[model samples]
Target: MKINDILTLYDKILIGFVIILSLILLLIPFYYFGSPAEGEELILKVQQGDELIKTVAVADSYDEPIVFEVEGPIGIHTIEVNQGRVRVQEAPADDPLKICEKTGWVDREGPIIVCVPNSLSLWLESTNSDIDGMSW
Candidate 1:
């Protein structure tokens, strides 16, 4: 083939190769880390005046602590649980400048309960089966 004809053929092949590479790159994330496999189970429990009240379970299995929010009569509460540990604290009662306390605990993935002046919450994390957040 002539030089010009060879060049045109090469251009088409290069373009096709680029398109395929781009598509493969886009799919790599979905294949590797897009959907994380189930992680360890985490459970949080809350108590009120010596009474067990609320419980929350993190569905996705993860090694890192997951932050969640709880609301009570006094104000909003922020909690973080990970590796069978629980951290509960008071948050701002109003909007704008809310802060969370640093009280935390650690235990097996079974029952973690907390009480905020009569208001209570609980978290239950399990690794035996697949549990969703709603199950909490």
Candidate 2:
């Protein structure tokens, strides 16, 4: 007859399970995708071909974003750093695919962005790898 009278025990259990599952799904991404802890810092190395050209440091938090330009084999590439994430802000208009510019902000290592046409690339390094022969 009424809402409470019509509902059964299984329906309430299913609703509670769904709510808990939804909460977990919402939080897991922040755990896995978040940048390193505050003050840890991120090191960015911008290279042209095999030669290293610029080294930039990104703080976990900053007042203003840092921008720089690198002269690659073809032309200049603009790099920007905000907070702890770095990205290829601009590449030469003639770039083949603009892959680097589309890479967006990267806060973690291992996902290096490269522009083959310009022979320019940038890589982020983690400060956690301080292993020595003894620790290994």
Candidate 3:
């Protein structure tokens, strides 16, 4: 075919592809991410050497959990806050895995506390906190 005819055919194909792609894109948000809804609260507590540190209210914005690192007389610690519960866990002694420890506490709408070294964790998903998101 002539170059002009070829160009016209290409343009028609491109237009058809764009229309199909646009329809597919419109359906993605509803199926993949869904509607944007308010995140639930996640409360967490860390205890070390007789002192307890509670995390401030963590707002829901990101899908990933909020990570909090604590250092005290007991040693280094990591906390993960998601939904409305806190996951408090002990840091590894040797070749520690801070990220893995943080991932250990993953709850959709509850607390999944884990203290690896101390073998202590308070997981209360149904329980309500004093300040909705405050861990005490």
lDDT on C-alpha atoms for all candidate structures: 0.55, 0.79, 0.51
Question: How does candidate 3 fare on TM-score?
Answer: 0.36
lDDT of 1 by residue, 1-136 (tens): 7767667877989989999999999999557433324665444556555565556665432566677776666666777666545666445455333312433454544334445453555555455544343323
Candidate 3: stretches off by over 4 Å: 1-40, 60-65, 82-90, 94-103, 108-136
TM-score of 2: 0.66
lDDT of 3 by residue, 87-108 (tens): 5544656425544356564443
lDDT: which is higher, 2 or 3? 2
Model 2 lDDT per residue over 2-107, tens place: 9889889999999999999999999995785455655455688888878998887766337789998987667788999888788989988777788899989888
Off by over 4 Å in 2: 1-34, 37-39, 130-136
* Alpha-carbon TM-score of each model against the true structure: 0.37, 0.66, 0.36
Which candidate should be chosen as best, given lDDT against the real structure? 2
Against the true structure, what is every candidate's RMSD? 12.9, 6.1, 10.8
Question: Given candidate 3, what's the lDDT at residue 136?
Answer: 31
The order by descending TM-score is 2, 1, 3
